[model samples]
Target: MSSTAERQGGSPGGHPRGLYFLAGTELWERFSFYGMQALLTLYMVKQLLLPEFAENVWGLAALRGMAEGMFGTLGNVGFASVIAGLYSGLVYFTPLLGGLIADQLLGAKRTVTIGVLLMSAGHLAMTFDQLFVVALVLLILGSGLLKGNISSQVGTLYPQDDASMRDRGFAIFSTGINIGAAAGPLVTGAVAAIWGWHAGFAVAAGLMLVALATYLAGQKHLPDTPPRRHADFQHPPLSKADGKVVLALIAVILLTMPAEITYPMVWTIGPIWVDSYVNLGFVPATWFGSMDSIGAIASAPLLVMFWASQARKRREPDSLGKMAIGTGLVGVAALGLAAGSFIFPAKDSVPLIWAIACYFLMGVGWMYYWPTTLSLVSGVAPRAVVATMVSGAFISPFIAHLAAGVIGINFKRMSPSAFWAMDGAIGLAGAVLLFALRPMLNRALGTDKRKDAPENAF
Candidate 1:
């Protein structure tokens, strides 16, 4: 009944029908998720809220976006563009917590299902303007579950030392996410713009449902079993020493985000809020959101090719090392945004290409970070902690987003350049954090560079 047997024990690349089914499910789920994600900030400022502080900053951003689009140019604004910076920043932060839960409690299969379901509900909830905040809470929580665990499962499909195939496998998996991102916004935004915002949420919900059903259909094929992990409430919690370690870990994470936290003070109120301006018909706005996704999509083949290029080398960077470099470079990309502001000061918006370049670089950088990280975690993490780690990784992005919305929103209203600069610093800090943890990773997983290391697995 296992996939190996289903394909008559063929290689994973030639996995049985269920693998494709799982892949399809993920593709659809990502479509719903990214579609809604594409429009969130815009919707927040334009349609969801009123002419309050939140709306003001968002409104200005929208106006700026409109003006630049009209004149065929984008500009940098006064005060940090905290809202934009924070939203972008957060989407990555929450994953740490999400990944942990998946590794320790939910297991890959259940976590993904529950997370996807929650996200689907969250999207549906957003359709209710009155319940906007509640919807956000649900979406963040749901993402914490689904985003981290599902990715880990993809890694779990193979053995840990199977280096030759892991990168290619992840490359295949990441595409499902990009495919969703590429199509989601265009379709959902068009629907929402022509029909209503609620329609967008509804479409997202429908897509998630399809993903969910698709997941269920192949339930028999998934090797992971999580229900057993979370059913252990009788067990005592970690010791005080462990608790302190967890607290310290959190402190480190928090300190890494100061610019991210502090910048929103001005933008929410000053002159640039979105309600204070006009809306650019849906297409361009949605298209702008699609930029990061496009970057993500563009990276898959490129990274896979890069991995292939390394084949001739005696010491190829392992998944972990590549992830480290990728994430660190993401920091560099953020810095590029700061540099962009310097290049084009006081215009209505930063050059579209500047933002686009940032997105593209970021996509290439971060694209390699997670897929590889997941493979490493699945490879070396003790079975007991695998789901937990996944949950934490997933949760980190949610954490990033939650903070982004609360603080980044306010920051964008204040100083724009500072916003871009802050994200660059954050990306760098995340890279450093991983680098610092390199010893732990190296010890447990074996070096990614060594061809003699363990088999490359899921």
Candidate 2:
């Protein structure tokens, strides 16, 4: 009975009720995740990593001395970047192991459950100075389980044969992510500004609990995870064409690292830059994180329409071409920041609107590439290797964060323009490389064939 119910497709409304359930689950999960993230680096620098914190509290002089000795000559921004970079990077890497665990041992539902629980506990633990490391470990492990599985389950909610609807479903699902992204910083940042950083973290923890509750309430609606059998573990062999496509994708992912790095770098440290340079009287730095989400949400419907119109006219860019443009846009976003820095040219902060503008451009860039890449993989990879390609997609962030962390170390050494200019160059290089490879990608993946309906705009 359970299996039969799980096999049931979309509802009378032509979409699955499960999609809404999963979307709600993801919405709250992201709410908690980004909320905590918005505060993390600031919290670390203000409360944990700096000498001032230890100076104010008793029996902490040794800790302050240790940090000062270890991070010599690097300013607070650079030191904070190291910690943020490692934490952000490791979060992506854990998903690899989490995916394996979900496939082999616990199943998606159970793994996601465990992940949510750990994440909730991690957020709560952040209130304590002594348990900081433990908190990070729990959050990383939990995110690993929840992130991939929840997304995979969204695919399971649809019938196998309905390709068009499935793509639309993912598009709808992604909007939920953007909604959370926009709201998290606003709520958490405001809370921190009023009460304190610990309060902000506590709010994130509460949101995670809400997410857990939401998921559990919709448990009956969610598809069941099939038990893994040893004999069923083997992957089907990829054809020569698929093999070439896979290699092409690998190259693409490597080149997109600079673009990927922009996300974590901006969210973690962009606020620091804002705080140092921008003299906004009352605004919280974390509010800057919302710009990307706000831009994405505002432009989603518009972009969908634009793409659909282009597809109808046979003028829509291919996945690789879109990614090239997206990559270039991220560089353009960095350039925006550089422009603002030059305009200010003093120790004082520039108008907050300038930073907001940069974030909006980044949001536009993200909208083009991030969601599109998933569909590209689904469309291009052979059915037998789809799962492999999806898993491979996760590797981009893992590599991205590691390199971003290394990049973060240079924060203090370079001026704002120089730092951003460097990122801009990298993004442009990736774009040029992908543009050169577009012909090959077009042949391997074939042109977009879903012109039958505009609803397939994902």
Q: Which candidate comes out best when scored by lDDT?
A: 2
Count of backbone collisions within predicted model 1: 95
- TM-scores for every predicted model: 0.67, 0.90
lDDT of 1 by residue, 310-417 (tens): 655434566555666776767776677567666665544455555667656766775666556555555544454445544444344445544544444433344445
- Judge candidate 1 at residue 254 and give its lDDT: 43
RMSD of 2: 3.9
After superposing candidate 1 on the true structure, give the runs of residues whose Cα lies further than 4 Å from its correct spot.
Answer: 7-13, 51-117, 141-171, 216-226, 229-283, 315-324, 346-349, 382-384, 402-410, 429-458
Range of the 10 consecutive residues with the lowest summed lDDT in candidate 2: 449-458
lDDT of 2 by residue, 1-458 (tens): 25423434555446677777788889999988888888887887788766655344333344335545765655666666766776787787788788888888989889998999999999998887667767888899899989888899898887788888888888778878889989999999999999998899999999999989988887888878865877987767787877887887777667667688865567766877787887667888887767788988988888889888898876677677788888888889888877888778676567888888888888888888877787778767777778768777867878787677668767678888777777777777777877887766656565434444233322
Give the Cα error of residue 359 in candidate 1, in Å: 0.7
| Residue 77 miss distance in model 2 (angstroms) | 2.0
| Cα deviation of 307, candidate 2, in Å | 1.6
Model 2: per-residue Cα lDDT at residue 284: 89
